[model samples]
Target: MIAPELLSGLPSTEELPCSDDTPVDNEDQNSLPNLLLFMLASLWAERMDWYFGVDMAIYHTTGEDPRIPVVPDAFLSLGVERRKGGRSRRSYATWEENGVVPTLVLEMVSHKPGGEYGAKQEIYRQLGVLYYVIYNPEFWQRDRHQPFEVYRLVDGQYQQVFSTAEADHPYWFPEVGLGLGFRQQRLGGIEQEILVWYDAQGNPYPTPDEVQLQLRQRQQELDAERQRAESERQRAESERQRAESERQRAESERQRAEQLAQYLRSLGFDPDQLPEQ
Candidate 1:
C-alpha cells in the first residue's frame, strides 16, 4: 500500500486547478485485467490527441459535494482537448465532460467467479458506456467456468461480440484506427499478451520499441552511405597524386636530356650525331 503522506504529496485526485468542483479518482492495482487496463491507458495517453485518463477517480459533482469515483484502466473523451492549458489532469468527471460517460470502458474480471460477471455486468449496462470490454481469459474455467466474453452494448443490453462457435478478434476501434487482437505482444513486456488491437489493413500496430528500431536502422544506413562516399573521394585523391607524380618524373627526365644535348652541342659534338655513340 502507498504511504498516506506520500500519496498526499501527489496532487489530490479531486483538485483540477482550472475548477474548484472537479471530482477525483483513487488508483489501485487489482488483477490481470487491471494490468491490461493500465497498459491500454498508457498507450492511449502516449499516442492519441484526446483527453484520456486511466485508473483515475471520476466524480459526478464539482467541488460542491463528495465524489463517486470509479477508477478505470483507460478512458477517452474525443471532444475534449488532448491536454489542458499546459498541465495534465489527475481525474476525469463525466459531469464536466458535457455529462458524457466514457466512450469506451474495459473491465477485466477478478478470480472470484460470477460476482464480477453478475454484479459488474449489470452496473455497466445501467451506466450506459458505449463500449465495455470484459476479459475473463479462463480465470474461472474449470473450477467455476465463467467463460471469456466481450460485449457491445446495443440499444440497452450488451450483445455478445465474441462467440465460442467461431473464435474472433476484438472489435476494430475505428476511432483509434486499429482492431483489437488477443495475440502475444512483446511490446509491453507482457509475454503472452492478450487484448491487443490491429490496424485497418489487419496489420499489428507498431509498438514504441519497433518504431525506434526502424529509426535506428535508417540512421545506420545513412552513415554507411556517407562512409562509402568518403572512401571513394580518398581513392580519387590517391589516383590524382599518382598521375601528378608520373608527370613530374617525365618532365624532369626530358629537362635533363635537353641539358645534356645542349652541353654536347656547345662542345662542338652534335647531340643528334653523338647519340649513336
Candidate 2:
C-alpha cells in the first residue's frame, strides 16, 4: 500500500527528511552484526564522497506486489549524499531518490528460501546493484564450509569471491575511500564481533557512542584541573596579604616606642620608663 505511493515519488536527497529515519527492530541478538554493518556502510560512504541510502525495503518490481515493501538487512545507495543535512534518514524510498537503488546489497542469511537467493539477487541486479554480499556463518556452505562471500556482477552474472582471496579488511573498492572487513570488538561486553570501517590500514573508526563517551571523559578531567589551579592561586594570594599585614604591624610598634622615648627625655623624665633588672 505505502510502497507504490513511495515508488511513484522518490524525492531528491536535499529534499529528503532525516525524520524518514526508521528505528531498526531487534528481532534477534544475532542481528547485532547487521546493525554494525548498516552504520559502518553509512560512515564509510560519507568518507568516500558518495551519498548512500541504507536499509529498508520496497516492492520488488519483477514479481512482488508494487504496493508492498520488503525490509532489507542492509543496503547501500551510491550517488546519494553521504550525510544529508547532518542527520540520518528513517527509510529509503527509491521512487523519491532518482529511481537509483543501492549499488551494494548485503544479507545476513537467517531464513530466506530459494526465492530470496534467486529472485532477490535478480531484483537487485535489475535495480542496478553492482555487488551482493552474503554472510552465512551458520547457513549454506559452498566450498563445504565458509561463512562469507562477495559476488560482483561480471557480464551480468554473479562471480563469487573464493575463501582464499586478498579481499579481507581494507577490502578495497576503487569507488569508496574505505575498505570493508570483519574485525573483533567489544560491544555490551561481547568480544570479537565483526565490524566494518575505513582502512587504517589497521586503525579503527570510533563509533558514535564511543566518541561521545570519550568527549565526556575529557571534559571532566579539564574541569577538575581548572578547579585545582584556582584553589592554589587563591591560597597563594591570601598568604602574601597576611605577610604584608604582619610587617606593617611590627613597623607601627617600633615607631610608637621611639616617640615615647623622645617625650620622656624632653620632660626631664628617665628616657627609659622602667629600669633594667
Best by TM-score: 1
Tens-place lDDT digits, model 1, residues 27-111? 2123333444444455666655466455556554323342445445555566665654446766665544455566666555444
lDDT of 2 by residue, 153-231 (tens): 7787877753322224434444545545555565545664464655547455665545567789889889888889888
- Candidate maximizing lDDT: 2
Which ranges of candidate 2 are over 4 A from the true structure? 1-55, 60-70, 81-95, 111-119, 140-145, 161-170, 189-194, 245-277
For residue 124, what is the lDDT in candidate 2?
66
Residue-pair clashes per candidate: 8, 13
Model 1 scores a TM of 0.67
Q: How does each model score on lDDT?
A: 0.56, 0.57
Instruction: For candidate 2, give the lDDT of residue 230.
Output: 89
lDDT (0-100) at residue 212 of candidate 2?
62
Segments of candidate 1 deviating more than 4 angstroms: 1-49, 60-66, 111-116, 138-149, 163-170, 188-191, 257-277
